[model samples]
Target: MKSESIVVVGAGVIGLDVALVLAKRGYGRNTTIIAEHLPGDTSINYTSPWAGANFSAISASDANALRWDKLGYAYLLSLAAKDDKDAFVKESTSTEYWDEMPSPAKIDSMAKYLKNFKEIPAGDLPSGVAYGIEFTTITLNAPMHIRYLLRKLTEEYGVRVVRKRVSDITSGFLSKDTKVVFNCTGNASRDLNGVQDSKCYPTRGQILLAKAPHIQQNVMRHGKDYETYVIPRPYSNGNVILGGFMQKGVSTADTFSYETESILSRTTAMLPSLASSETQILAAFSGLRPSREGGARVSKEVIQVDGTGRQGVLVHNYGAGGTGFQAGYGMAIEAANTVAEELQALA
Candidate 1:
């Protein structure tokens, strides 16, 4: 067997997950993460800190996306059930409302683990909603969870995270032992040297976090014009996250006061407890989801190493948009599989 070494670019949820998958595949001792940002950093470029990170069948209609989601959901369930206090994944009742019937395929797939899953009566749903699905799922406190992944990667997998950005993918393929480079650069892929994906752009999102310990579930309203969601973080006396607007073609990460007020208004109306007298505003922020024109790109490509005739594969894994955390592990598994194939061919 070839002595395997891998370099994963970016350190957001997606990057970290990809590295974790690589480690799990027995590359733990040879994985290195190169990124300009890490878990605790707060910036527009880092989307993980600003996510209402939860496990939902958001891509129920897409076969590929759904496969990733189901895999991630099962993995998280295992973590949550294992009694590891720092697992950062917890179960909650989740509800998603739509204006019409969801795809039968989606409903069927969810029924596998969502034993309590059921369609809601139109009368019980919020006004203007035509259908709904309620099921048990998990939510992640992204900041805390990112830190947890960092520790896991280091302590358990021997993966090291380097605080630096790359100008080219070949930089990671420099080592004679490095067989492949995983490009998990998120939106940075739009401008990153050697992987300028013009289709990559930001789908901006904003949310307000408020103190609401009594709220214990996740609720989402899906519509043609607007979408609203309320996710309660059950750990660390964490605040409830109320969101948001999916302003496509927007790149700014500045918080809009009115948007905050609008989210508060909509979420409180959906979950009245959010408007309780004891509720207090904790914070409001914005993030740019790494969205691509076609959807997430999780395939591999071969690139010639700079100044050297040798060639190596560059596995692309960005453009996950808002569901980065939700779809992270699943995508990572895919990336890892790609890496394994490339390594095998090299051998």
Candidate 2:
């Protein structure tokens, strides 16, 4: 193994972070990132840009998931510490209301990892809430975060980025001798050649962006299969994200008026002023979350390069669903470690 040539098949936050970490580990120059779309471009296929990118341990009950969140929290905290310019991420208070009580083990995990985690007093809990918790978490400007990641990979780390559609994961291969390949193609894996993951499915998320600078904190309400959240953008003339649904197997580009109205109606109850004319509601759009059954696939797999006799280390890092931003760093670190270990073993 030369520890020189590598390929990552997407440019979303997950792929970018994986490339960045590998670059830092001395795979800088020869590493190539191939993607159909790059940062600053708008498309329904690109989900990270449309995210209300924030940190929440709502998905961190499993030990592996919690570990990823923990690593991400520490890394995100470092960004918040030096965010005098509000470049990457911002720290904010997050209050979550659940219609059904989460298991005590889940609450304990949040308490152990989340900053200033606490159970909301019964009097403090809002109506229709069976459980509540308050904690400090970090929110990100999704667009800025991805662009910054791209700059770091190209400028700071000398990683190469290619803009082209790949028919399959193997299309990103630069050379037959390539020691490692990362599959970060999100939901594309379902139809993606050489990786038709039948379990990979799409979950559509709808959100409304409004100018609500007065709202500085994050609020989330979960009931049965539906969820509504209010996430104020870090520093964007008071733009807040109001959302959403996890409609499985739905990937239509259409945005319905009733869906927007429903979001506004439910969210306005939490922040009455959001209904006022003073708060201008901007765009209403939807994107597909690349969800997989049985959670994200974050492991090492060995495989032959199709027709080629040579084999390479393939690190699976996609299927994060909506938790990509919250758990990206940890997953990147874990994937990069595997690349390093395998490269050494092959060498």
Candidate 3:
């Protein structure tokens, strides 16, 4: 019998992470990745690189997303502590609020997992901010992390990555031996031929990167009007990410609006030291987060092509919205487990 081959669509963080998990689990050696976009390319269709790429616990009361977030947080922290520390950093993050009250149960739930959980004294918080929560979380330099994952997949696991656009799955590319297909196309899923899921939509988020001097650690402020967060990148890069605005159904990628500027100005005003500093504005970028109506959609199904009686397994792992990096590992694990189970049954 010939070995099975699987083709994973999309090369963003989600795709690469799933590929890594599949490879690690002793999958087919002929696995290949067909993607129109890859890391380091600042394309609007790809949202992995534009993330503030930190582990912030903001999922709703859904059980699956909550499980994925918790699992991903532990995986990222382990990576940061073990070998990827230079690329990923674990630090104490302070989430402060102004006139917004997060549930104590939610805060305590997050604290149980993070290290150094605490509430700030009234005097220590910024004016008009009544509460704060400090806890440990991981941050990743998204470009570097994605590149690292790709490198590992290629160099270590021998997975093949090809740069191509896949319009239809049943065309000439798929084979009888191809038992499963994993879709991680992020925002492009709405247009991708075989998987035109109408529920998939883009939530546009814009961010500003500036070289801040001597500021370390992550800070976030939440309010009814706006939410702002600043995360320090790895390697003392001096570049911190200031963001962001979440506009739903807006797909324009060009960073031309003054609205993003206003967002940055408001964020800096919340952290005055960042505004008054001499930090040079490096760049402003926008990414459309792949968000579904309910939450992230991960499931397994068998799809029958037009003429081919052969059915191929389709495992969807997209609709992460803005929390891709934080939920990448766990979701990949779950998706891979589903694929493995399907493959085992077929065998």
Candidate 3 lDDT by residue in tens digits, 120-199: 87788787786787777787888778878887788888888888877775441366767778888888778778878899
- lDDT of the structure predicted as candidate 1: 0.82
Q: Write the per-residue lDDT of candidate 2 for residues 1-347, one digit (tens) a residue.
A: 43236888889999998988877777777688889989998788888888887887456467767778888888888878885244568889999999898778768777887888988998888888999999998989888888888988899888888898988666656677577889888888788887888888888999998998778889988878888899988867788999988798999878989999999988988767676766888899898888888777887777776685667677888888888888888989998887666655543
What's the CA RMSD for each of the models? Answer: 2.0, 1.9, 2.4
Quickly count the clashes in candidate 1: 0
TM-score of candidate 3 relative to the true fold: 0.91
Off by over 4 Å in 2: 1-4, 83-86, 345-347
Candidate 2: residue 173 lDDT (0-100): 60
For residues 69-169, what per-residue lDDT tens digits would candidate 1 score against the true structure?
A: 77888788777888335967788899998866668788787787663788787778878787888888788888889989999998998887789867876
Better model by lDDT: candidate 2 vs candidate 3: 2
RMSD in Å for model 3: 2.4
In order, what lDDT does every prediction score? 0.82, 0.82, 0.76
Q: Where's the lowest-lDDT run of ten residues in candidate 1? A: 338-347
lDDT of 2 at 293: 86
Q: Which residue pairs of candidate 3 clash?
A: none
